[model samples]
Target: MSALILTSVLGVVLLYLGLSGNKSILAPTAIVGLVAAGVMSWTGWNPGLMEFPTMLKFDQMSTLFNCAMIAVTVLLFLFGIDYYRRMEENVAEHYALMVFSLTGALILTSYTNLLMLFLGIEILSIPLYILAGGKKRSYRSSEASFKYFLLGSFATAFFLMGIALIYGVTASFDLAVIGQKVQAAPNNVLFLLGAFFVSIALSFKVGAVPFHFWSPDVYEGAPTLVTAFMATVVKTAAFAGFYRFLQMTAMPPALSDTLLVITILTLFLGNVVAMRQSQFKRLMAYSSIAHTGFLLMAVLANSAMSWSTLFYYTFTYALATVGLFIVLTLAKRAANGNEAIVIFRGLFRANPWLALVTMLLLLSLAGIPLTAGFVAKYQVFMLAIGAGFIKTAVFAVFMALVGIYYYVLVIREAFTPAEETPVLVVSPINWLVVSACGVAVVAFALWPVLVG
Candidate 1:
């Protein structure tokens, strides 16, 4: 809870710094504040005490998620030092808005009440709507921002209505009360409907199939740094919140069957559509959806290891994603703003180390052996099978195989030769971030204990 206060204060501090117009200090300041918040989160864990009369709670699981997200946000801020250096306007707001969004993320990991859940999703999303349009000069950015706002508002309405239905039936918004009331969930049609509505809203936030139309467009249109935040921090928080929701509710037959269909569609569609993308950012957007399919499986499994596996999986994904986007920023500059996968051509010749690191990061995302992604997927499949969903697990494995091909395409481009290669300059800070992520993925893969 104190960590939440600190980050909220940190956001206001960043806005004040923005007023000074000295953009030079924004990233560094945000980084320091986030590191402190992470430490506070780690040290504040107490499972028995429900803070604020069950509005919030700090447990071992939430603490791990809080620290993991803070670590990822710190990496993004470090990357921002270089990503935002060339831009002259609203640089501080970019940093501040992200910090504020992260504050909402912290709230999500700790919330124990439906009201807090609604508040957390709103606080997290409102800033992103503005940040998606940060590139005011780009028509695509404006379109992305407008589309996200409209769709997000629509989802929020469904979410509020679901909460209202739940409150009407149970006469309370506390998760514990809902848990007691939902034990006979299979017989309650209204509760099942409410759960279904909530599921759709959370699925939209996580970019699952039938609700993922906003991702590719927004990712392509928004700046790379903002896209990285959307893919990592936003996703982790949503899943954590959803995990809590699942933990507290008894799954009725109707809701469970509905979710199984969504999972299969997400896995099938997210992988199949990604193979057709030519642009790097759009490819990442779809690829992200593919990962969501895997994670949705884990959430459905809901085994004892779900939280630990989620922390490891999402944290490693964040590492690879941040590094790849940094590489993209360099490659895009070299290509004169063209974001096609072909821009990666001759990357091996230009800088072998960057190319090699790029392969490792991509390999991790592809879930290749001895990489963090492999361990994450392996654990998810085990969970699914253990939960008696053998057929679903088999289909997921096939989808994961399909997912590997798109990543290989990017790797092929990076290693391919080009007639005239443009020089890809790497800033010192960017190089450090890329290398750190490259090392961390392999380290966590070899030593899975690095997470919990």
Candidate 2:
């Protein structure tokens, strides 16, 4: 509760700083507030407590995710110092909106009531709608915003309707109550339908297959920084909320079967579609979808250790993504904002260190051995196999190999000589951010205890 309040206050404080025209202090102030909030979250680590009559619950899982969110945001803000340096206006609003969105993410990590769940999704999404259009002058940005708004509204409606149906069946909005009711009436048709609706809504949120049409377009259109935020922080929050919901409910076999189908579709589609993409952002958008498939596998396994595995997977994926996007931003600039795979050509020749870091990040994303991504994928595979989903595990491994093909393609471009030298510009803070992410990825892979 204290951490939530602190993050909320931090957002307002950033808005005031923006209004006061003190732009320089916004990032630093937000960083300080986030760190403090992270520390406060740790205070509620063990013996998880429920607050607001069970609307919110803070457990070790929530604390870990909260801290990871804060850490990722801090890295983003540090990178923002350089990314937004040239922008003269609305800088503070950008920071504030992100902080506000972070507040929503924090809520998601802890929400125990369906009402709180709805509120968290809205709070998290509304800011992103604006942020997606931050590049106001660009038509692509406007299109991205409009599409996300429309589709997100539809998803929210589905989610709300699910809540209504669950209430109708169970006469309660509290997760614990719903869990008790579900356990008592496991075969209730209305309850199963409600769960199905909720699952669809969350599938949309996480950019899973069939519902992932919006992601590649929006990612390509939005500002790269905002896209990074959506891919990392927002996705993490959605998955955490999804996990919480599933953890509370007594998932019927029908629901599990439904998830299994979605998982298979998501894995195959995300990996195969990505192979043909020339745009780096779009490729990554698909890559994120592919990862969602793996995460869903963990959820499907529903082992006692699923939550821990999920956290580790998301944390490592976020680290690699943050670093890769930072490098992509630089590459995009070098290519005059082309956003093509070709932009990475001659990267190694231009900046060996940057290229090396990019390699490590991409390798991690490809699930190469001895990287955090490998450990994450390996754990998911083991869990799925242990859960008796051998066929699904094998299919996922094949899709992972397909994913590696594209990632390696990009790495090849980085090493290949260019027809002409692309003008690459590296900001100090950007370099620091990428370096930190790279180091963290390798370090955490070797020492998983750091995350635990």
Q: In order, what lDDT does every prediction score?
A: 0.90, 0.91
Alpha carbon lDDT at 412, candidate 1 = 97
Residue-pair clash count for candidate 2: 0
**Candidate 1 structure quality by residue, lDDT tens digits, 161-210:** 88888888888999998998887454777776777788889999999989
* Candidate 2 residue-wise lDDT, 258-370, digit = tens: 99999999999999999999999999999999999999999889877888889999989998999999999898888877899989999999999999999999999999988
TM-score between candidate 1 and the true structure = 0.97
lDDT of 2 at 84: 88
